[model samples]
Target chain A: MRLSTKFSDTIHLLAFLQVYSDIKLTSAVIAASIQTSPVVVRRLVGALKNAGFIDNDPKNHNPRIAIDPKDITLLDIYLITEGHTPLFVIDKETNPLCRVGGNIQPVLTNIYGEAEQAALTVLNSKTMQDIIDSLIVHNKVKQAKEKSDLAQDA
Target chain B: MRLSTKFSDTIHLLAFLQVYSDIKLTSAVIAASIQTSPVVVRRLVGALKNAGFIDNDPKNHNPRIAIDPKDITLLDIYLITEGHTPLFVIDKETNPLCRVGGNIQPVLTNIYGEAEQAALTVLNSKTMQDIIDSLIVHNKVKQAKEKSDLAQDA
Candidate 1:
């Protein structure tokens, strides 16, 4: 159940890029914002660049969004990073003598693939803009709740 | 994308149970077949038992399937184990000054929930019998290929 923080960090980076499209952002700045190491940010930035999600100019060392926020989906980022890795790893030393153990790998692999595809389908349906809009709505709701609480106290 | 092997191991254990329903299975035996520690198997067995997926008689210390294999889906096992855990975690220390960093957690949580639900839907569509049937098919194909190779060698 424990997954690497790569996907979460990737989305954080992409959302940051979208929100601050006007600002020139560096890995160090991103690392600072994400509270992660610059090396980690640089590594993920490399992946994003390779996936055609971001543009990291060699001359400036500044990274920018390459795809439109409306065009990019969370699933797109998930595939580029975590999606490249298998969801679960089959045990390498399962007892071959057991009928289930001998053939479980292929069965599990097929099932995992189908499950991952289903997840990807859902993620593909949602764009970065959709995430941002939801965030905006959440922020408004929070502000309204706080305002209501403050008024009740008065 | 690296997830814990609990789900895979759970399926392995369940499929073994279905295939060998006559045998009184112990954690040690299950662990041996799964290539995992007995402690790990015991822990998962506890979860499965608590979730009403399996029965562990205290007097015998042996486990048995409580539900019909045809009635149990991978999604049921997923829900009892890995599905209880969050698919992704948000960075708690993200820089609050950054707009996206400040608001990304809720947005990401929402998206992860939807994606997980979609995956669960797919998994729910497949039962343990389906996996066992596929495994049987695979074994036959493998045996047939081996027989053909042996014929050519002879």
Candidate 2:
């Protein structure tokens, strides 16, 4: 199975929100940043809003999304936007005749829960704000390099 | 997006191999345990062999698959078989008119690598053998309880 881009889009959107906290980031703006469609961004934002990862004013002509980057963990955002099913999925029909298959589902479910918890343990250690902070620093360095290059050309 | 049954099937296949190492496990037995067609089991077994996760005889006659469960990590097996793409998926087309859209793919790729690595770090901790051991213990307890229930009925 392939990893979905929705996960990365959510991450980028959260980071952008953190950097632009003073101003509301529209779905169009986020879509531009991620090079995706506004509709896609809106769908993700909807999920984020429902999950309490972000807030928006639908009463406004064009809704503006405000995300509390500090309050949100990557895990929370992941669960909200891109994480739908259990971490590990078992799609095949288990063998009913075998003792193992008859009971392995519950056992595997328990193990998958532990494994997912372990994965989340690492993800919880990171905050969306931290990712945003790093991105801001990266953008600053990039701008500085471009300025230095222009100066050299002049 | 979803976990495939390949991981569990691989584990069960390995355990069966360990138990009947001297004998070749025909697709029939594996299919019986997997509750699928022998053709399906053979196909999966073929994929495992191609990935070097298992070894099969060159002759099609009663091909025996040898798996070193201890040497194989679930992450390794997954990467070989099901881990070909990014961890998350994005289904929408990126906007070509936007600069971010033009660059989003590469940027996401870099970030995806890091995020996937973090995920892999957790998956790396457990091997298929470890899961099999747990299954064995669980199965034994269940069997013992069933036998007791049968005796109590008498």
What tens-digit string does per-residue lDDT give for candidate 2 at A44-152? 7777767666665555433333655566676776776556666676645777556556555665676667667766665666676666566655556666887999999
- Tens digits of per-residue lDDT, candidate 1, B1-154, equal 3567888888888888777766768778888899889899989888998999998646565687788889999888887877657655566778765677777777888788888877778889999889889878877887898899999999
Q: Each candidate's DockQ score against the native complex? A: 0.61, 0.42
Residues B49-138 of candidate 2 have per-residue lDDT tens digits of 787767755654444435556777768766765676545554355544433333344554544455667667767777767766777787
Q: Candidate 1: where are CA atoms >4 Å away?
A: A56-62, A144-154, B23-26, B56-62
Residue B122 accuracy (lDDT) in model 2:
65
TM-score of each: 0.85, 0.77
lDDT of 1 by residue, A91-137 (tens): 66688767888888888888888887888888899987887787678
The list of candidate 2 runs beyond 4 A from truth reads: A1-3, A18-26, A56-67, A147-154, B20-24, B56-67, B89-115, B151-154
Candidates' chain A TM-scores: 0.81, 0.75
